[model samples]
Structure formats: structure tokens, C-alpha cells
Target: MDPFADTLQRLREAFDSGCTRPAEFRAAQLKGLSRFLQENKQLLQEALAQDLHKATQLDSAFIRKEPFGLVLVIAPWNYPLNLSLEPLVGALAAGNCVVLKPSEVSKSTEKVLAKVLPRYLDQSCFAVVLGGPQETGQLLEHKFDYIFFTGSPRVGKIVMAAAAKHLTPVTLELGGKNPCYVDDNCDPQTVANRVAFFRYFNSGQTCVAPDYILCSPEMQARLLPALQSAITRFYGEDPQSSPDLGRIISEKNFQRLRGLLSCGHVAIGGQTDESDRYIAPTVLVGVQETEPVMQEEIFGPILPIMNVRSLDEAIEFIRRREKPLALYAFSNSSQVVKRVLAQTSSGGFCGNDGFMHMTVASLPFGGVGASGMGSYHGKFSFDTFSHHRACLLRRPGLEKVYALRYPPHTPRNLRVLLAAMETRSCSCALL
Candidate 1:
């Protein structure tokens, strides 16, 4: 049986009926969503803890946003509810029906989103489709007007390909091995604290988390102990027992992270407990470019340090790889920070910090090249799910004025029309 057929058809019918077209209806749906968030706040947080162990309330802005019919939101396990709801909010507010597909990996969060979320919105205009890979493939067989996917690059490619079949637009929020450069001029302790906090936040499962560090050998020497200090201060002597520390989401991810620890010399925190799916917040030095940890996005509590002699080399090294989702550079000198920012390309850049660039609603969040494509956040999310229609209106009473270019055009008339068009162009330019 086609699992998605009934719900898709219902949403399609609802859209066709123009039920979601009215401004009041959209406002009501938004209100319902607000209530859902308010009523189920603790449940959502518990689900997040159960999922991979993870808010900003943003203000609404006025924009000429229009919905793109039915939208499919495929959210990742990491930050599952946030990613799912971020796009869903935009779609709903812009007046479109949505089919939210939360990650199957996070079963607890998936259950809450699939079961509890739908009740808050109109059944005809909203639905939650639960599935793994095979089921997702089946769901993609049907057409959607717009698709917003947040996950790995491999699955992002698959989503893009499926969207291609229907010529549907997509926003892919994918992952990459984001790099952080620490300059010799900066205070090692300050840089260490900032990097350590973000690197180990949510056990470093975040897509925009710093995956590796690029710095001079001297800087590396200073940073190693400072980072150790930061790790200890944040998670205490044993990260395994730290309440702030999180466990790996699954055995597959745990094994992958465990394999990464052997890539280079462990600088600090290399402990792992398979029974609890815990891998300590680890740092490695002397890592080679070809190593396994360097090759892929390290979506765990593992940090690798690769030595670069100068800022130029560090920028060049980042340029050679796929553009990352987020990039970081730490330096007391503003010129040094600006130089790195000007030299490298990333979806987002942060100086003297981590992925805090995503905290503000004004900034758009996304990836570039192999990292991913398109972006979403506050207004960007609304714009991503909307189709800007070009419209023009003209008065019908200007028959004689329009007839000059119709059939019998004299040379004088041609010159007059050309001059009028040029004048209009110049006027628009001035405006």
C-alpha cells in the first residue's frame, strides 16, 4: 500500500479547496502551532534528550511571503525538533500544507512529532510521515511543491535527485568538516574555552560544530594544555559522569567516533563506554590530511588539530576542501580575524567564537558547494518556501497611447517610443 498517498491527497485537496489561502486561516494555524509548543514544552525537551541529546524565540517580520503549496520537511536527528519546526513554522505561516518527516534514528522525538504535532494543526493541511530510508524513498515518489531537507550530504544528494524528478525547489542543510583556526596572537585560554564549549555542545553532534583546528605548531603547543584545562573545567575530570556531557546517539555513531580516536595522538579525553554510548570529549594532535577523521564530518565529541605554519596556509587548506557549513577563526588582532574572513569561503563565518552566527534570526543558515545549498532561518525560511510571483498591472483605457507601436509605425513614432522607454528606464534608475 502507498502509505503517503492518503495524507498527500488530503493535503492536496485542502490546498485545492483554498482552505489555506485565507490570512485568517494561516494565523489560526500559527496560533495552534504556538499552543503546541507551549503545551508540549517539557515533552519536547525530554524527546530531545532521548534523541541525540540536545531555543530561540524569534520575532516575526513583515514580508510579502506566499506559500508554495505543499512542502516536505525532512529533519535530521541532531536538533530534530528545532530543524523540523523551523522550516515547518515558515511553511505554515506562509500558508502552505506540510508533511513533516522527522528522522527515524531519533525514535522518541519522532514519535512525539508524528503523533502529538498533527493534533495541533488542521488535519487536512498538516501531516507527519514516519519512515526510514525505504519508506522515505517511497514517500518521495509523490510530488511536492517544495522540499526542505536537513541531514548528511549522501542523503541530501538523494533528496535533491528526487526533487529533480518533479522540478521541485529544495533547501539542503547538509554537513561538512568545519575548520577552526587559532592564531598565535590570541589568548590560548580564552580561545580554548569558546572552542571547547561549542565543540562539545550536544556532544558535538551539531552540523555547524568545529570539526578540526588549524594553527601553528607553537600555537598548538599552547592550545593543547589550555584546551585540556577548558575540557576539565567544563566537563570536570571525568566527562563520562558529567551531567552536561551527552552520549553518542547510537552504536553506529559510537563505533564511528571510536574509530576516529585512533587517527592521531590523543591530546586529552579519549575515554569511551559502549554500555552507555559515551565517548569523552576528545582532542587529537599530529593528524594527517589523509586520516579518517580528517576525511569526513566528525559529528561527535572528537576534535582534531592539524598544524599549519601560517594564516595563508590555513586559509589555503580550507579552500582546497569542500566549503564548510560553518568556519571559525580566533585571534586578538582584528586584522588577523578579518584576513581569515576575507580569504576563506564558508556558509557562515565566526571570528573569536564558534557557531554562534546561527543564534541570530537575521542571519541565514545553510551550506555551500559540497556542504549543501540554499539557506533558511527567520525571513530566509519564509522566502525559501515561497515563490515570488512577478506581477504587472496596466490600465485598459490607454488604447490610443498603446496603438502607436501596433501596426503602421512611422520612423518618427518609432523614435518617440524608443525615447519614452529610455526615459522610463532612466527614471527607474533614479528611483
Candidate 2:
């Protein structure tokens, strides 16, 4: 059978077989996932390194634990293991069936997961499907009780559209140009340091990574130097050798980033060695919105900084663009903070911080509009997969009380009915 038919049959059969509802069963599956991650940490970490230029273990370990307890994570290619397994841990804990779908582009990591999870958990209850477009296409054809997708917004739309056909609830953790605002009141050094770290992580191939920076002309002048110093402190002068920095994922990604650099003048670190797949951490200034890099997601080590006349200009710039998946403001002024928060619509906003908000685990991390739809993290993932079946059993004692309003047309009965139903709690809630 095809993956879709198999998965649907299995999930449906499992439900009908009374296999998924027991707390003990769910607890056991969750525990197995946690132990699986702890035991196989190094193997998975190494595979990500081989696939994507860098395999940052800290983020990997953080996301892995999510699925072990109570989440069903469907992670994407950019940060495969961290995104995929983290939410799975959360689902396992919540006692839900976990059916994961890893990206097809990264075949190596997919192979590793297909072998590992089944060895640790009961294959019947917790299973993962490894296939390409054909299988994934089929998997979606059947309605998942809940779905979590992290990718580009274009694909997010397709996922949501398909989900709507089944009336299946979904959470799409998608990407858009996440904005970073640098207000004049903020400490230039602190703000730039934070921005540079996140902007360059994974060579900027991240959903929450700040896509561009907005600032006043005066602060813009000061911010770049501070950002340079922070980059040096973190990665050192010889960034290629620095353990903190890593390479681009593949030749295609290297070319894609290299192509964007061609459209504008290189402000800093424009050098790249194609054979090495090393694009030096670069920064660009004086870039226009029409520039090739500005027109697309600069998901590379290249950081593009733009100057805005005032805070209002920055907000307007954002408003004109698609609603971003994540929005960030770095300001000490409470007024600016309130204004931006109230004026803007983003999937999530980090006040005086960058991507640290996603680490909270307690908060639902997902996007809105062009960024994506739905949300998953912690309890959000568990709820995403299971249907909330509300129950109301009618009691024998309430039958006569409700019957008078069914068919009577008398004025006396109408008056009596209005009096009886005047109580707030009397509406169908009593059943």
C-alpha cells in the first residue's frame, strides 16, 4: 500500500482498536521517545551537520525533548532533527499517536530516523513515514486529526487548503521576513550584538531569524560597528575556523546566496569559496527594497541593514509587506513598544529580544497570514492531533421542563417559558 493509505488505515484502525486512549499507553510511548533522543543524540546531531552546513546541538537538544513527552512534530528541511523530534516528545507525553514526516531533500537524516524510532518505541502505535513527494501527497490526502507544518508560506497555504477540505485542524509554523527594529533609545551595543548572533545563526537559514533591520539614520551608523564587534567576539577574525560558525548546507544554497550578492554592493565579508561552501558572514548597507536580496528571503550569512527615517516609517514598511511570521522590536521606550505591539500583526513578537521567545515552550509558536497558519509547541501539539469531543447526556429529570417550549402557541405558556428560561444557566447546558 502507498504511505497515505497505510498511515490512514493504521491510525483509523488503531483508534477503533481502543489502542490510543489509555493514559498508560501514552505515558509509555512518551517515555520511550525521551529515552530514544537521549541515547541517539550524537548520531542525529552528526547527520544534521552533514546535511546542513552546521549542526548546532543546543537547539537540537532543545527541540528533541518536545516530542518525547507530548507533541507530534512534522519538521522541515532547514533544521530537520530539532524541528521534527522536539514537538514529538511533547505529543508522546500527552499520549497521542505520533506520525512524523521529514523532508525529502535530506535523505540521510530521514534514513536515520526511519531506523531509530521504531527500535525504541512500539512500532504499532508510534510510527514514522519516510518517502518523497508521492508519499507526503498521499499522507495529506487523509485527514490527520491535527497537523503541524513548518516551511514557506506558499506551501503553508496548500497545507491549510487541503486541511480545510477535511475540516481538519492544522498548525503551520511558517516563515516570512522577520523584522528587527532598533530604536534610538536602545543601547546600540546590546541591540546589535543580539541581532548579529541570531541573523547569522545557521547562516540565517531559520524561520525566526531576523530578515532585516530597521533603525534611525543616527543609530544605523552606530549599529553596524557594534554588530561587527559582536560578530568578531562570537566567531573571531578567522570565522571559518571558529567553532561557533559553520558552512552553507549545499552547493545549491551556496549559489542561491551567491546570486543575491551579485545584485548589490558588498558592504562586508562578500567573499565566498564555492568549493568550500563557505560564505563569509557578510553585511550590506544602503540596499533598496527593489534590490534582488531585498526582494527575496536572504536566508544566508548575508545580513542586509536598511535605514528608516523614523519609527513610523519602519511600521509602515512592515505594514506594506506581507504579515510576517515573527516580528521583533529592540527598544527601551515603553511607548514605542506599546505602539508597535498594538499597530502590528505578526505571528509572534519578541519585545526587547529576538528569537528567545520560541524557547519558552509554554507559549504557542506559529505564524499568521503569509507567514503560516496554526500553531504547535508543548500542549498545542497534543491538542492539534486530537479532536475535542464535547459530551452532554440528557438527564430524565429535565424532560418535562424543556417540553413546554417545543410546540405550544398559547400566551400563558409563552409567559411561563420566558420566566423559566430567564435564568442564565438554563440554556441546554443543563443537559
Candidate 3:
């Protein structure tokens, strides 16, 4: 017998039963999820500490935010707790029956989620599956109403393929090589502080973290010392000993990041520890666009500097690559910042700073093009997990008024009907 057969059937039955359709029930489940988080704050934090080795940190309209039936949420290991709970919150609040598949790589947190999280919600409406890629692939063989995945582009493609088999809709939140542009008009020290803080946060494991720096050679020279100063102030001389610094999540990733250190001249820190899985807050200078460090999403504590002679050159360089998940520009001149914003395309953009734009709940978070598709955050999440079903109702006695829409084609009746159907002066306004 298939292991997932029973659970999938059960959740499908629960969704079909209409038990999860009520607004009050959905609100109650959301509250239960909140209570679970509030009550297990310490446990979840401990799980994050054990798994990640570091500290932690919508909407729609009158269209009716109805659930997409049974939802499948596949979360990544980097932000095990957040990536897991965030999509779960959205699915529940949207009134979907959910099956959460936590990353097997983050075993500690996975164990906690599987063992502890389900107790807080209706068992028939929710479940936590355990396993690695094999189990996930097997689970995907079955159909789901909606799927939300947070991971690499490669896996996102696989999830999309699987969803296509069932014509199921999906929301993929994938990572990319996010670029940060530092203009000649900026304060070197302030830019350095913000860039260094965000780039090295969680050992640079964040999906939206600035992956590399693009600037004039002169700005690079000035930023090197200022960035060194910020690093020392944040993590001290030996980042290895700093409690604030995080370790690579796995041995495989540690080896991969170690290999990236060889791509360019290590201007600052290049130290690594296999036993601790530590990669120091490092900076690379004189990196080329073709090198491995520049080609891929450097999801680690390694920041490479690439030279762009002017603002036009910088924009051209960014446009040449696939659209990134996030982009950043820093300059005293608002015109320079605005120019970058106007010229480029990305999932999100920040000016004169790092990823603070994501901290605001008003904004939707996800990627575009190669980064991935679909968005969710705040009300956006609710909308993403819901199906906007178009509905209309009319009085049974309105046959005479509705007759204009029926057959019998007369010129005057047609003109009147067309006029009534046309709600706006401009047809494009509906777009």
C-alpha cells in the first residue's frame, strides 16, 4: 500500500466535506496556529538554534478568499521555522486543508514540526509529512489543489512539472544571485555598514540577501576598508568566535562555499572550518562576470565585488542576467537611485539600503523569471492560496429584465444590451 494514499485521501475527504469552508472555522484554525507559535516559542527557537546554528529573527477583495482545497507546502532548510510556518499560516487562514513537508535536511526542526505542530490544529484538516526527496516526489505523484514551494530553482522546476501533471496551481519562492549597486555619490561607510550587516546576516543564507556588489573601481577601493570596519564592529576580528556568526547548514554546502572562495582575490576574510562548518565574513575583489561566484546564487557569507565603470554599465550588467529576486542601489543622488529603479526589472528593489524593504508586511515577497513565480506575504499570502471564484446571483422573477441577454436579436435590443453590458468608457480599464 502507498504510504501517502491514506493521508491524502483523508485530507481530500475533509476538504470535500465542506468543514473547512466557514469563516469562523478558518479564523479559529489561524488562532490555533498563533497559539502554537506563542506557546512553543522556546521550543521552536531551540529547534532553529540546533538546525541553523544561529539566531532567528494577503488579501483580496470581495471576491471571497476561499481555500484551494488541500494545499501542499514544501519549505526549505535555510529558514526552517519561518519558511515552514509562514506558508502554513497563509494556507490555514485561507481555509485550505494542508499537508506540510518540512525540509529533511534540518532534522532537528523537522522533528519538532512533525511531532509538535499537528497537535494544535484539526487532525483531519492538516498533516506533517516526514522524509527527504524520495518521499516528497512520491507525495507529488498525488494531486493537490495548490502547492507552495520555497527552495532552489532546480527543485522549483521539478515541483512545477509535477503540478503540471495535475494542472495544479503553484507558488514558487526560489532564490537567485541578488545584486547590490553602490553608486559613486554614496557615503562609503554607511553603505558598507548596511551591506555588510545584511550580506552576512545568518551567514548570508537569506534568499533576498545581496549576493554581490557592482560599483566603480573607485567606490570598491573606498568600500573595502569601510566594510572591514563594519565587519570588525559586528563580528570582531575573529568571526569564527563570534556568537552572531552562523555556520553552513551542512557539510556539502560548507564544501561548496569553500570552493567559491577560490573564485577571486579574497580582500578580507577567507577562513573556513570543516568541523564547525564555518565560513568567515569574507569579501572577494576583482571578480569576473563569468566566474562561478558570479554565475550562481552565492548563498553564503561570501560577497564578491564586480567593477562597473558607470551607472549605465551597472544597469546593463544587471539587465544582462536573469531577473534576480531582489536588487539594491545606494547613492546620495535620488536621481541615480531612481534611474536604477526605472531601468531594471526584478522581483523587488531597495534603494540606498539592503533588504529592509522585505521587513514591511505591506509588500509582497517572492521572485520573478528564474528566481521563481507567484508571491505571498501579508494579505498577498491569503490571495495566493485562494481561488478567486467569480459568482453572481439574480432574482428568479427577473426573466423579462434578463431577456435582453437571450436570443431574438433585434437592433434596438442589441444596442441597449451592449450599452448596459459596457460599464466603463474605456475598455482597457478592466485590465
For all predicted structures, in order, the TM-scores are: 0.83, 0.77, 0.84
Q: Compared with the true structure, what per-residue lDDT tens digits does model 2 show for residues 1-431?
A: 47699889888677645566678999999999989977996797688769974431011111122222222346688788888886676566556677888887667787888888679997767878877668777777876666677777777777777778877666778788888888999999999788888888887888888998888879878887888788788888878888777778778889999988875566667888998888888888888888888777777888788889999899889887888888989889988987788777899898887898888878988888888776777777665554455444444455566565665336676566655544453243211
lDDT of 3 by residue, 1-431 (tens): 69999999999678645578778999999999989977996798689879985330011123555788999999999999999999899899999999999999999999999999989989999999999999999999999999999999999999999999999999999999998999988899999999999999999999999999999999999999999999999998888999999899999999999999999789999998899999999999978888999988989999999999999889889887989999999999999988888777799999988888888889999899999899988988888998998543334564566676565657676566656655444221111
Q: In model 2, how large is the Cα lDDT of residue 246?
A: 73
Most accurate candidate by TM-score = 3
Better of 1 and 2 by TM-score: 1
lDDT of 2: 0.76
**Candidate 3 has what TM-score?**
0.84
lDDT of 1 at 296: 96
User: In candidate 3, which residue ranges exceed 4 Å CA deviation?
Assistant: 1-62, 424-431
Residue 290, model 3: Cα distance from true site in angstroms:
1.0
Question: Which candidate ranks first by lDDT, i.e. highest?
Answer: 3
> Where is model 1 more than 4 Å wrong at Cα?
1-64, 423-431
